[model samples]
Target: MSAPPLSLRWRRRDEPLPAVAVAASGAVVTQLGADALMRVTAGAHLRACVGREQSWLVVLGDEADLPWADGAVYLGWDGGLLVPTLAQPWPCADLLREPLRRLTKQQTGLIALLPELVLAGPLPREPLDPARLAPS
Candidate 1:
């Protein structure tokens, strides 16, 4: 059978989210709903997203457009970077490379059964990977 679709939670657009603020301070986690809700917006719009923005939404298209974001790190069930790595250069992971792009890179469980990560922070110092640990 095919894998289940990934679960994504997002905040309402009318109200701005505190993602950037938290990023500026630090990134943390939790399992419970009330626990993780802070990752996204408090209230405005929330739902399961087949796709979510890692950062903010510029809304280039309809609401159907993967919760379009101006910024945020999106990860599919398999953990591929959602938005576009077309021209962005990641510090360690050459997003252009096949292996890096295909694998579930840094999409870890922090909040939202899965959370869209957005930040204008510094690129990682080295490749943040744990490939050897995967079962082949």
Candidate 2:
């Protein structure tokens, strides 16, 4: 079967830009145990799985492309960062049932899912720049 078409959405043109630290890397590490996120510089594979109200991040050496499909929504992207759009009302239980996966390079990493509560913090802050985030 064919895969669903990937759709992307950018932040409003008037919104402020995101921080450089969070928007400068493609490969990011999810410190699930620590309740924090870290950006990595090496890795060939990217995997994101959801369960209960939490999302899991996995990296491997196998090369792959960004896993995108229907129903998936991306928040923003800068010259270096990409954010995932999660469902509403804090923890998105819906994503836990249907997870997403992608094979991407370190320069093209993945930001699987971000809960609403997390969004209130300082992680993702702007829409992605399609021109800069697109594969070159």
Candidate 3:
């Protein structure tokens, strides 16, 4: 009964970012940490640490422009990790209700989120098999 692995795409500033699969509501939470889920509240940008040194930042605000297609979520690089910038405003209460998906790309690593910030336990020993999770 463990949470599914989170798929991540590491892109440089010049590369074309992956498109995030979002619903009409324009809100989606990608599992991008080892044991933590980063929720992008309507106007809030939170960074969740993954594993030991790596971290994923979820940015959502009125100024961000997130491109949306029929069934894909796109992310942009902020000189570091992949970031999905949501242009629309999503209520925190509603974001909490949305089901978190294993955000995956063609060939990338996987991660997830934990509830507590102090709980920095080691990631699962097993390496993620991208074949198991759905592609983003």
Candidate 4:
């Protein structure tokens, strides 16, 4: 089978989502993690991405975009992070990477999911020119 198409979305907190269009390169992800989200946004040169709570701004597209057909693994929000239930499904192992499993409850669950996005392969790392990113 082929992989589902993925999408990426970002916005500053407590503000309206700008109508900015991204390149067709398909940078995208979920509770959407904070660190991973900030990293990408920072790379995109969104000002102040790392300065505030960014989890909500980090929408890795619809939750449905996740490989739920493989099956859903129950996770919980503990302390400030997402904790998986003991009944972990082996098939969906890709959903939980090493960094996520090691996160302390004190941390945001969003931070754990960043490595997976990075490991998905190299993204367009060249700095984006601000002029090309003007909102429609």
Ranking by TM-score: 2, 1, 4, 3
Q: Clashes in each model (backbone N, CA, C under 3 Å)?
A: 11, 10, 15, 2
Q: For candidate 3, what is the total of clashing residue pairs?
A: 15
Cα RMSD of all models vs. native, in order, equals: 16.7, 16.3, 16.8, 15.4
TM value for model 1: 0.20
- Best by the TM-score measure: 2
Per-residue lDDT tens digits for candidate 1, residues 35-133, read 223222332232221122222211111122323222333332212223222222232123323443234243331222123343222222332222211
lDDT of 2 by residue, 1-136 (tens): 9866434332333444331122111222222211111212232133232222333222211122233223333333332233432222222323322223222322223333333212211222232222222222
lDDT of 4 by residue, 1-136 (tens): 9655433232222332222211111222122232333444544332111112211222222122211211223232332223233322222345444434443232223431221231121223343333323222
Candidate 3 stretches with Cα past 4 Å from truth are 1-71, 75-84, 93-126, 133-136
Please report, in order, the local distance difference test score of every candidate based on alpha carbons: 0.25, 0.27, 0.27, 0.27
Q: Candidate 4: which pairs clash? A: 29-60, 33-110
| Better candidate number, 1 or 4, judged by lDDT | 4
Q: Which ranges in model 2 have alpha carbons more than 4 Å from their true place?
A: 1-11, 14-44, 53-64, 75-136
The digit string of per-residue lDDT tens for model 3 on 40-87 reads: 323223332222222222222222333223433344332222333332
The predicted structure with the larger TM-score, 2 or 3, is 2
Model 4 stretches with alpha carbons more than 4 Å out: 1-67, 87-109, 112-136
In model 1, which runs have C-alpha deviations exceeding 4 angstroms? 1-27, 31-42, 47-88, 91-97, 105-136
